[model samples]
Target: MADFPDAAPLATKLRNTLIQYYNIEENAWRIAKKTKDTTVWRKPSEEFCGYLYKTQGIVEDVTNRIVDHIRPGPYRLDWDSLMTSMDIVDEFEENCCVMRYTTAGQLWNIIAPREFVDFSYTTDHEEGLLSCGISLDYGEVGHNFVRGFNHPCGWFCIPLKDNPRHSLLTGFIQTDLRGMLPQSAVDTAMASTLTTFYSDLRKALKA
Candidate 1:
């Protein structure tokens, strides 16, 4: 097999792909779940057999600060509950890097811990900031952690016009947690996890 290509082109492609996903019509998505904090929608993933989930909520922070917390950096590791550990494996530029990270198990360990090496990029969007990432087949799998792949995932943070301190945060997630797992479990875990994500992030930002 040919070697994986450079990160710059791949990063650009991922950014454009995420923009396309973001621009998709609202009617295309079906409601997955709704909570007091967020509403999540799902549609068939274009990259994998799994479903692509879109989560939207109002975050109580500015767009730049919110994107800083969401992207690969110190803020993410400090606050994100599902992320157990992270490291920047390689840096392409100030806005792009390759990060290796591991997520904690979910749903009473039904979904075991998983590791991923992803090319992450943060770019300016029409609305505000877009922090996007795509999994890369790089580095050895850590012991006891299944290697998971994130197709093309990103978070778009746009500052609210009326409340500049608050921003509208939208995310697109399509992760292929490769393993012999039941489909129902995956669906349930994803929806609930995403809902909880908003709550956790809000709390963190407020702190």
Candidate 2:
């Protein structure tokens, strides 16, 4: 929907990343966190670390309703505590927007806030399968927000055919939180934050 100079390439990368999540080598990833309805796995490499999370038991809200709430736009603040603010820089279509997202650093007092712009696109691939990707756009840098390059994240929602009242949600993200913090600290913080985030989401939706 949104037209950008690099939209095509970004979409390709997003698709590839989605594919990678499904094809990730079993030996390469280890369970970092788990709950009754959610599990998060991590695979660390020299350049960047990848996280894959799967959660079921979310109330089967319509695909569009869930997507609207999660997209990096104005509504994000209502559910995401890590997000300080989000502003839409440009909008191309109903399902595509370029937005600037500011997230508080894991260590609020020590680390500065991280900010980046992303070309976010969402589509219903088919009935019962909804996916969206937010790919980093390095061209624009917002004030007071540091750029963390190559951090792309996305999610997929697949409704169960037998029971339309529930769906499986999977999310993947690759980030380079550039800081002096130890790798162990980063991993622990991320794992904890992610688990809490999902738990909070469930509560928000119920409310």
The best candidate by TM-score is 1
Clashing pairs in 1: none
In candidate 2, stretches whose alpha carbon ends up further than 4 angstroms from where it belongs are: 1-4, 25-27, 45-60, 107-111, 134-144
Q: What would the TM-scores of all predictions be?
A: 0.96, 0.81
Listing every candidate in turn, what is its Cα RMSD in Å to the true structure after a full C-alpha superposition? 1.3, 3.6
How do the residues 39-126 of candidate 2 rate in per-residue lDDT, one tens digit apiece?
7787654335544443233545665556666776556788888878888877777767777777887755455677766777776654
Please give the lDDT score for candidate 2.
0.65
Question: What TM value does model 2 have?
Answer: 0.81
- Evaluate model 1: give its TM-score: 0.96
How far is 109's C-alpha from truth in model 1 (Å)? 0.9
